[model samples]
Target: MRRWFMHLGALVLAGGAAAQSPLAEFDPADFGKVVIQPRQSTSGAGGIAFEQAFGNYQNEPVIAYGEGSQAVRLGRPVGRLDMLFEDGSTGFCTAFIVDDTHLLTNYHCIPGLPRDGVQPQVKAAQFVAGYIRPGHGEGVDRYTVAPNAVEADRALDYAVLEVFGDPSQTYGRLELAGVDPEDGEFLWIIGHPQGQSQHISREGCAASSPAVSGEGKLMHTCDTLGGNSGSPVLRLSDKRVVALHHAGDSRTGYNMAIPMARILAVSKFLKGAEGLPAAAPAPLPEVPAGACDALWAEAKGQGCAGYGAYLASCGTHAFAGLARNLQASDCGTAAPAVIHGALTVKPSGGDFPTLAEAVQRAPYGARVSVWPGVYSGPVYVTKDIEITGAGPRDQIVIDGVMHWSRGRGAVRGLTLRQGVAVDGGSLTLEDNVITSPATGIALRGGDAVVRANLVQQTGEAGVSISSNGAVRVEANRITRSAHAGIEIRDGAAPEVFDNEISDGAQSGVYLHSGGGGVLRGNEIHHNAFHAISAKGAVKPVVRGNRLHSNGYDAVRLREGAGGTWEDNDLSGNRAGGFRVEPDAGNVLLRGNRE
Candidate 1:
């Protein structure tokens, strides 16, 4: 008795045209009808496989009998359930065996059963399992798990019941299917489909989709109704119970089952001592090439330990385990081996051979340990490498310059005397001291980030940004330079911020050649030229600065300089606070104290 609807043309109904096609008699009274379709083979298989398949899933069989119903058979009878309410009325529930001692059903199957949360509870409850056709009255047997120990995932609408009693009361255990069945596989459900222990059983083939009402790992068909909310949907191929029958589809002839895998994942039955099945083990991923060599290189007897720790101490290395593993490998005087993976390395030899060599040997996503020493070789890095000192006192010094042409790079927590230049890579230099060079750090292409570093005693500009490289220079101390302490040229957007520039031969900060930069939060004083000079510069934001004590004007904007000058404290300078000539447009000034 499945629900099927069809709409024909008005002509057939009015008998105005063509012959009348005989259709099934329509009845509004039989709104809830059950339909059983013939089984068909569906061959599609193998998407997400499972660990184990279900075995024989029947414990104690039950029988169903009613006025409108024919003879029905239940695979495993979830016997009488005891439903205790807050009003003191108790009713028996339908209980099905998942294993020897575990009972499976909907969480709402037994209302007012307080096993957890902040609720009042009693220690006593009744369970009834096995039932048979009495030939006259209700058949009865003992097939119940007691105490209903735990509940979980109430949002999933499922629950597990733990029966605590003698084992002789039950016959056998019910098995759960490991994976989803074929599309058209035969499915069966046995439960109290109308609050009657008449245990109705209906056989139907799996449908393409849910029957329109039920959802999430459910099947749509015309086979079930109320009181069957916690029944089992079993696959006959291996007698496996796949999903817990939760609800029926209202739109079409269908019912829904919660997959066994999800139940097994969150269930804690096997954790108890009541002879339940254990969970399947997890699968492992494939190992990479030279995995053993890489592992051995990170083992003890290596000389590279404190390098990663030092980087972490300076906020240079984001990942900490890489440093510990590099210290464990034995670099064998050739060079310090790179530490990749999750282990710790303790290098037994001296510091890394050279910064460049250390970078070349370390893994792609790892840090190289550079102990405190004067490293006088050129470091051309191509990957994201972190080079750090051994300790504050044991500093890692680079006596020579560094050159990077491609890829991205980062240099942190190390002092450099020679110069550093990046041509194509995105580079970042942080928390270091650069001295003696004409330019402390220079970038020509890609992007550059120079932050929290000291650039002092340079014959030329302390830091220079050129060659179209978008540069961000912030929170730095630049002093004692022959020319401008900081210079932006070659058509780049240079952000100069929060810096102290003093005692320079030329301007404290000089902007030229169409430089698009922001000059803010700077202390510019004691310079030969203007404290801050913007000549032929474009789009410069000059504000929030202490500009004074210079040989020329406190701030100078001339020669078509497109910039802003305001909110500045220009005090005790030789020339006027600001000297803005003609041809300077898009300039704004407000709230100044000179």
Candidate 2:
């Protein structure tokens, strides 16, 4: 016989009252919204419109779980996980304790499993339990997740990790249900929605009959958002975990989750009836001395005729080890014809026909040389590799976006037509000519070195850095940008020095939205707007630059902007040298000659 929680309706009414109550220091902007793409309707008949489906949505604060109720007790194991990536960006997700030393979360939240010598992108991760609201909670405690002790499956969209401090001993863990939830069974979800205080979706949450989708995901109607990716879906009847919420489609009025039973079927952590022991870590493979010499001899013996086949026979791990050995050995010199250990890409009749093929086949930390030809666009680089063009920049072109997402690498002596975007890694982009329909270079969450490049005629700013992005912009020629020559926003602080910035439709350099950086020894002139414009909580250090011959003022600081300006040559402008608005926060002007 199944037992259900009584007074469910009363609990929901109490939840509404709690949600309406205001809390201190609750800033909506601090929470990052998870953007979910609209999925095609599974039902041939178009589902109810999004407006109608969510018109009476019933998601309540976790406090609504009620005092001394089973809902509150079961929610004790849920927590908010904060992740710091290798690129210096931070993100948050939801997770729950499964065992004394283990926690469970979505695979997408922690994609880097520690097997096969692959390092995870997440540099650090911590879980905070009882985070009921901003600055408010009940017995809140924080624990760190061990980076090396992670078991994950991308296909299943789940990860089981060992928490270093064994947090479950204090909060207890949720028990997985032996059977799947029945059709139309009432369920409830508890998680941090949009990185806010924990919330519960229970009023109208229910499991659909025949809930399993083609991908083995359970379809349900639960109010969820971006940070709710790893929330536990519990059966109201028994308070046992039944599913792991992963995604939602507002258009179809349905959310998807991985059934707990399905995850248990393949979980190595938990074993049959009597739980089995966790597997021990595997030993590292040994690379014998002269391994690189032997591999190079084999490739040369084949006359490089079957280089692709040879790479496959060597295997990714083996070749990666060999590449390391070669880098450390004396045979690492660049040969005039066919450099040893470096893959060559040409338009035709080379080691690889395309740059993409060469990059994909190259082992970790390998070098790829492109020989004076027009390669295609949208080349995605995920590892550390140096790609250099053989001839002049204009002769070697990549017609689309060069997206760098992980590791550290460099691209030199090439002409990039569309532009470059770095979101999750460090890239050194140097000695290149770049032009684009949009911003010539966009940096969101990574570090980049933009040096010795010619950037011109972009649809937007010549270079843009935003949202925790760190870049060193130096020794570049920037001109004819549709907007500012360099635009910085959203908490980004970069170093700008020794560049020629001119002929922009807007300011030569614009800083706003809490952007700040050091601008030194640059020539800024001939812009449609001010030479430099700072606004809205920005505090940049402007020093030793020749800000003259512009259409507007040399510097304009307004709307609470504050910065240090010293030793700048401000003359020959259409407007005055400096315009500091009364509302500006603070300005330090010294030795600036007009």
Candidate 3:
């Protein structure tokens, strides 16, 4: 999540200190000096949900064996199987194998939807597993299940169906991944939408956060429609089904899936179902040996590099020991290759000893811990490495020096200053404070996660990612900048969540050139021009945010690009509650107020 602080000129708000001049409408062209009272509603979005029911069906090959009668049970043991009722009419829904005898679907898809908090009909359905058209499509298979014993969560808008049957024999079981995938991992959704295709699957990524409280999970991207209810969402990494699709806020094009962890928790609450035992924790794969040896070797090679003479130690034994202990503990195993060595600056070497040296010494997929102190120098890395503090509170300050250049790298828990450049690479800079820099962080690569940092007093944009994989920016404070607080270039899908961006020169959050992303659960206030600017950004979702006191439009959409603005309160922006430029596309503006 690359973000910046745009200058919104200061102004006075209702009940705030009286301005030197009388109150008047705000002018966005000169917003940098404005101040307004807090607005209502959280400005944020939701992401995908991971469900445990379809653990194996999500990621790996599945093989199950059972008869239609044994595969599922709905409304007593005997009734018409593979049929359901909806909205007082007989509407059909399909159920596939979540487990041998377990099914899943939308709570509303059940025969009896909760009407006025009471069941109007007996909530029951049937299951039909291994429905294959022999000879016509020998290899293609389909399964059906009706809701029999159903448990639903209206807030999450999903339900779990338990069928009666020996699933191992009736159908192919799937391999479920137990871990959440890294960003950029390929993901797929399988189900019927609009009653068009059977076993239809939608592909996306484990891309794009919330505050610490699951705002990110509520704001994810997926192409789903009304009929996608009860579909299983699988990750390509481990084939583990993680989420169950449910309700979505169409305005932001952000879909919500119930995470598997929650389903398991809820399932436990529904224990005592016949033939079902407590859900077992899924197992993760083992890490190979000598995975991080490259880092140690690289560090030694750098120590020998001719850099006016510097000494640093690189080894793996300590790291290996830690890995073994971690795997034995509750946190699970550590990737042996993910360990990184520490590099300390020689005394009087200035701030950051030499970021160039650290990069040269660290190997791909390794972590490099930096010892704290002030060092005036620029740094650059070309490999995948985690650069973090030796220990929290141990500061490595880079004053008046920018770490320019790039090639898939990460910087963590360090202070940076002017001259920092992030040209490319799988880049991530977190837990750092940046001040007075040409640009706080600039990215041209994909697959980045930037979080938990302070970026202020910069001469240029605070954070920018023009291209690459999904970018997620969360939990940061950006104030008083020369340029936009956060600039997301068009053609990149970024999720910006939970940041306090105030008092900047231009727009607080600017999306240009088709900035297709979601802005949810944040405070966008007191900016010079527009609080949120969607210039050529298509279908951006702006929700649950507090937007107040901007010079121009509180939220502006231009160039035929549209966004869904919902559940947000707009006030004192000196313009309309929401403004759409001429020729803008279908930008849904709902659930918002002035």
The candidate that achieves the highest lDDT relative to the unseen native structure: 2
Query: Tens-digit lDDT track for model 3 on 476-589?
Result: 888776788888885777888998888888878888887667788888778888888877646778888888887788888878778688998887787756887786778887
Candidate 2 clashing pairs?
none
- State TM-scores per candidate: 0.42, 0.45, 0.42
Q: What are the per-residue Cα lDDT tens digits for candidate 1 across 52-157?
A: 0112222222443432121222243354344433433222234566554567676645332232242423234445443444332233444234544466455455
Q: How many Å off is the CA of 556 in candidate 3?
A: 1.6
Model 2: lDDT equals 0.71
Identify the runs in model 1 with alpha carbons over 4 angstroms from their true place: 1-348, 467-470, 583-586
Off by over 4 Å in 3: 1-340, 346-352, 363-366, 390-395, 400-409
Question: Which is the better candidate, 1 or 2, if ranked by TM-score?
Answer: 2
Q: How high is the CA lDDT of each candidate model?
A: 0.55, 0.71, 0.50
The superposed Cα distance between candidate 2 and the true structure at residue 199, in angstroms, equals 76
Evaluate residue 554 in candidate 2 and report its C-alpha lDDT on the 0 to 100 scale: 91
Order candidates by lDDT, high to low: 2, 1, 3
Question: What digit string (tens of lDDT, one per residue) describes model 2 on residues 1-594?
Answer: 321111100000122222111111112233222221111211111222111124476777776656444455557789877665564444556889887788888875675322224444766777878766444644677788865436787777789877878776556677676467778878999887656677888888999877677778788888765567688988764466888887654556788888887888888884222121112123224445366447656755563332433333343434543433343233442211212245667665456768777776665556777755678957888766788875445667899788888656789988899998888667899999999999999888777999999999999999998947668999999999999999999989999999999999999999999999899999999999999999999999889999988998998999999989999999888898999999998889999999
